[model samples]
Target: MATALKTVQSSEAEEIAELVALSRAAQEQIAHYSQAQVDALIRAMVWAVAKPGVAEMIAQQTVDETQLGNYDGKYLKIFRKTRATLMDIIDDKSVGVIEEDPVRNIVKIAKPVGVIGALSPSTNPEATPVIKAISAVKGRNSIIVAPHPRAKLTNKLICDLMRAAIVKMGAPADIVLSIDIPSVEKTNELMRQCDRVLATGGSAMVTAAYSSGTPALGVGVGNAVITVDETADLDDAAEKIRLSKTLDLAASCSSDNAVILVDAIYDEMLAKLVGKGGLVLDDDQKAKLQGAIWVDGHINAKVVAQTPKFIGDYAGFAVPEGTQFFIVHETGAGPDHPFSGEKMTVTMAVYRAKDLDHAIDLTNRIQAYQGQGHSCGIYSRSDANIMKLAEATRTSRVMVNQPQSASNSGNLWNGMRQTFSLGCGSWGGNGTNNNITWRDLINETWVSKPLAVAKTLPSDEVLFGDVIAKLG
Candidate 1:
C-alpha cells in the first residue's frame, strides 16, 4: 500500500508539471501582446461567464456540487463580481510604459510574472476563477487554478467557458487551466514549478504557498469584528450588519463575527437587529450552538455556510421559522470563548461596551485573537472616533457605515479594488496591505534618465535650522 501511494503521488506531481509547462508555453504566446490585444481578451473572458444564462447556470451548479451557500447569493456574485472586477481594471494600462514621472526622470513599464498558480476557495468558486483569470491576462500572464475539491467541478465548468472564449478570440486555450483532480501534493508541485502563487484559502494552504519556495500572496484568517456606537443610526447599522452577517450564509471572511455595541445604545441596537430577523439566543440555545459549531477548538465543517434552520437542528435546537440569523450575548474574547472567533455561519456574537474607547479595545482584542490585519467595520458618524479606531487598530481596511462583506471586497458603492483576495499585510503573515488584483500579478521596471542640469543638496543648517534652534 505504501508503494502504491508513493506511485500515485509521483504521477500527480508529473501531471501538475505538465500543466505548468503548458501554461508557460501559452503565456509566452501573449507575453508581448499589446495593451489593446490583452484588453480584448479580458473582455471576451468576462463576457463568457458574466452573460445572463451562463452566470445562473454556474451558480446553481456550484450550490448543487459544494452544498454550500445559497443559489441567489452565488448568482449575484457570479453576475456582478466578474464585470465589476473588469470595470476596476478596464482603464488602467498594464502593458509597455504604464506610468511616467517627468520631474523624477523615471518611466515605469509593466511586465507579466509568467504563469501564476491560483489556489481558489470552495465558497466563492463561481466568481473567483473568472476574476483571477482576467486579472492574470490583464498582465499578459497565464494562470492554472487548483480549486477546492468540493468545488472542482464548478471550477472546471467556469474554466471551460473561459477557455472557449479565449479560443474564440484566437488565443491559446491553455492560458487558463484547472486541476481536474486537486490534492496537496499536486498543488505543492504546481506552486513549486510556477513563477508565482496566488493563494486564496485557509491559513494552512497560505502557509504552504509561502513555504513553497516561490513568491506568494495569501489572505489572512477572517474573523471581522464590527462596532456600533451611540452616534450611529441604529436602524441603518442593524440592517447592514444583518445583511453582511447572513449574505451567502456568512461564507465571506469579512462577515460580522462579533458586534461590539456601546452601552448607551446596546438595547436599541439589539432591538433593531431583532427587527431584522435576528433571534437572540437564550443561554441554553447559546450553549447548544457553541457545542455544535466548534469541535475541539476548530469550526465544524457541517455548520459552515449552512442555513439557520440547519444549524439549529444540528445543535438539537429549533429556531423560529422566520429567524434569518442567531445573536448570542457574550462578554469575553479569545480561545476560552469560542464565539469571539470566526463562525462562518448565520450566527453572530454580540458584546456590550461602556463607550467608544471600550468598543475599540474590544474590537482590537477580538481581532488580535483571530483576524489580525484582515479588516473591521464601524457604523459611526464621528470622524474623530473613526480616526481613533483606525489609528488604534492594526487592520488593513476599516470600512465606514458599509456592509463589510459587501464593501471589503469592493462593491458598486465603494472604491475598494474589486477582488476575491484580500491581503492582510505582514500583520496577517501576508506580504501586501492592498486588495489583490491585476496590479499585483505584474512586475514593474523603472527606467532612469539623466536630468538636463544638476543641483546641489541643501545645507544641513538650512534643512535642520528649527531643530538646531530648539537644541540651542
Candidate 2:
C-alpha cells in the first residue's frame, strides 16, 4: 500500500490491455494443469492471505485508506472468508472428466473459462479479492480485478501478495492482477474483453456487468430483515441483532436493515434490546434521523458505514453513551419513508406485527418496496412458525435464530456456501439464487454416448391413467 493508487498509472486503455494480455498468458499455463496442481495453487493463495501479520497489515491499511469498515472486523473477515472458501473447494475436481457413470456410459468434464473479470466494492476490499482469487484458481482460471476507486490501494496490496505466491511456486505471476488506476471506462473494457465476469458491487456496477456483452455473474443490493416472535429468547435475539448490525459498521449487504416484532413481545423485546446496546428513538428523534440520512429520496452517503455515535452527532443530537445502533419505530413503508430501504449503517427500522399473518404480509410489502430476493430472518422456537415464515416470504434464504450477516452467505454453523457475493435471483435482478461461489465460474461439457438398447416411452394412456379415472 506504499504506492498511491493513481499517482502515475498511465492511460486507461494501456492498463486494461496490459492486465488482460498477462491474464490470458497465465490461463494458458493453468488450463492444462492437473487437479493436484490447481489445489496447490489455491493452497499457496490461502497461505499468503491467512498469515497473521499479512491479514493485520491489509486490514489496517484498508481502513486507513478508505476510512470504511472497522479494523478488527476486516482482519478477522480475511481469515474466515478466505479459509472457508478454500475449504469448500478443496477436494473438488475442476479438470477433465470430473464425473463418470459407467452404468450410464456418460461423463461430465470441467473446462476453465480462461479469464474472469472481477469487480469488487470498497465495503469488503480485502476479503472480496481473496475469495474471488481462490474461486478462479479452483477452476483453473486467471482473474483480473477492477476495484472501487476508494479501495484501489488495498486491492493492489492483496494482488501483490497473490502474485508473489504464484511466482514462488513457478506459476505465472499474472494469474491474479489488479488495476493500478480504476475508472468506469477501464472497468467496462475489462468486462468486455474478459471471458467471464464476477461482479460484487452496487446496482450500477452490476447493471454494467450484465450489459457488457459477456457472460457475467452480478449481485444486487441487500436489505435483510429479521422477525422476533413472542416465543423467542429476547436476550439471545437482541445479542444476535447487535452483533450483525455492528459488524464492520454494517458494511455487509447481509447486515440487518430492519426488524419486525410480534405485538405480544414488542415491549419486552425493545427493553431487552436496550440492554444489548440498542437505543430506541422517539418519534421526534426518528424524524430528525429521517432528515439526517435521507437526501433526494436516497440514504445519504455521509451516514453509510458509520457508527451510531457518529450518526447521532451528524444528525445534530447525541446518542446514549453505550449505543451501538439506533432503532426507530416505523409505521409506514415505501419510497416516502427511506428507512424502509437499505441504510448500510448501524441503524434499523422496527415494526410491530399484530400477528403472524400480519408479520408475513408486512415482510412481503417491505421486500416489494426494496431488496426482494435477498434474505430474511426469524427467531422462534416453534417449528410451525419457522416453516410458515419461510413459505410466506419471497426471499432466497430464511435464517432461523442465526446472525443474518454472518450466516446468510455460508458460515461455520450453517450449510450455506462461503462467498462474498450474494445473488438476488430476478427479484433483485440477478440470474441465480446462490451464494455466488466457484461453482458459478466454470462451464461443464456433457458428453452423450450410445446406449446398448433404447427404452420405450410410456403411452399417453398409461401416463393419464390416474387423471382419466378422476375425470370419469
Candidate 3:
C-alpha cells in the first residue's frame, strides 16, 4: 500500500480523541431512533453516493488520489458494493424485535453496538469506507473512519457525503465522522477508544485491531489457489480467472493468485488462458517477475496491485499487448516457491496436478503457505469434484464456477451475503466465517419464558441400559 503521497495531518492525538468523542455522542442520540428512522437513514446514505455521476467521479478520484488500482474497476466496485450492501439490509429488522421462537417463548432484540472504529484499505479505498459506513448506520451506530494515510482524501470524501445524508435525514452529521488526517497512532487510538473496531486492512493493521484490548472484527491475508478440474470448461474457467485477476488490477485480496490445473486439462487450459489475454511467461521472464515483486523474501509493495503491463515492464520485459495477466509455471510449494504465495499483483502461479486428489493436495499446500482460511475456488461440472475440494481444502469459502473477486465478498448472483469485508475463519485469525455485514454490527439480547414442562436429560443408567444388556 505504499504511495508517493506523504502529506499526513499532524495532531494525531487530538484528531482521534475528538472524532471518537463525537462518534460516541452521535451514537447515543441515534440509539433512540426508531427502526424506520434507521432504515431511512441507511437508504438515504447508500443512494447519496449511488446517484448519477457520483460513483464515477469518486472512482476517478480514488485512483487519481491514491495512485493505486484502476478507475474503471473502482467505479464498478463502489457502485455495485454499495447497492448490494444496502439490498442485503433492506428487509432486515435491526432496531427492535428481530427474531422470535413461539415454541420456546423466546424473543431476540437487536441493538446498536455503539461507536465503531473503521480502518479502510487503500486497495479499495472508496468502496470499503462506503460499505462499512452503511453497515454501521444500519445498526444505528455512529462510525469514525481511520482511513489509510495514502487515501485519506478519498475516505474523507466518502464520509462527508454520507454525513450529508445523515444530516438531511435530521440525524447528526457526526454519525459518520473521519479524522481529517490519518496516521498509525491515530488509528490505534481510535481502536482503543471506540466501543468496537471494524478493521479491513493489511495484516499488521488487523493484528493491531485484534490486540487493541477492545472488541473488534479483523480480517486475514489471502493467496487464493483455485483449481480447474478436468471436467471444467477450460474456456469458461479461463475467462473467470481473467476477470478476477484483472478487476481493479487485482486489488481484491480474494483474487486468485495461484491455480492448480489437472494434468488432463493443463495444456489446454493454459492455451485457453492465453487465448483470453493471458501471457504465459517463459522461465527467464518468470525470473524477472520474481525479482520485481519479491525482495529479500518479502513481497515488494512497489509492485503490488499494479497493472499487468506495468508489472511486466517493471520486471524488465514487455508483456504482450492486451495481456490482462501473466501466469508463471511453478514446481514447488511453501516459502521456497514464492510464486505460490500471495502476489497481490495481476500475476499467478500455475501448477500441474496428476489427478483430482493431487489437485486438492496442491491447493491445500499453496493455501497453507499463505491464504489459509480466506477462500479457494473450483470450476467443474462434477459435484464430486467440487465437494472434494471443499472437504480437503482449509478454506473459509469455496466458490463454484464463480469469479473469486466478484463472488468472494458478495454479489447478486450468489448466496454469499453482500459485503465489503470478508472474514477469514479461525484459520485466518478472524472471529466468524460469515461475510461481515449488518449482522456483525449489532448486539443481540435474548428474552425467554419457562417451558410448560421442566426439561432434563435421561439418566446415564437408562441411556447405557441397551449397551450393557448387549455386552452382558
User: How many residue pairs clash per model?
Assistant: 0, 0, 0
Q: How close is candidate 2 to the true structure, as a TM-score?
A: 0.95
For candidate 2, the per-residue lDDT at 453 reads 82
Which residue runs does candidate 2 get wrong by more than 4 Å?
Answer: 1-11, 101-105, 466-472
TM-score of each: 0.98, 0.95, 0.95
lDDT of 3: 0.87
Our model 1 lands, by Cα RMSD against the true structure, at 1.4
142 Cα displacement, candidate 1 (Å):
0.2
lDDT (10s digit) by residue, model 2, range 413-472: 888988988888988889999998877898888888987787678886887888877897
- Preferred candidate (TM-score higher): 1 or 2: 1
Question: Best to worst by TM-score, what's the order?
Answer: 1, 3, 2
lDDT of 3 by residue, 1-472 (tens): 1332322333555677787888888899999789889889988888888776999889999998877779888888778788888898888888889999988889999889999999998888888888888789888899998899889999888888988988999999998998767778889988988988999988999999999998999887888888999899888899999999888888788888998889999989989888888888998998899999999988788888888878887889987788888889997889889999988788988999999899888888887888889999999999998998899888889999999988988889888888777788889989988789888998999999898887788886787878877786
lDDT of 1 by residue, 243-330 (tens): 9998899988888999999999999999999999999999999999999999988889899999999999999998898899999999
- State candidate 1's TM-score: 0.98
Query: Residue 188 deviation, candidate 2, in Å?
Result: 1.1
Query: Which prediction has more favorable lDDT, 1 or 2?
Result: 1
Top model number, TM-score:
1
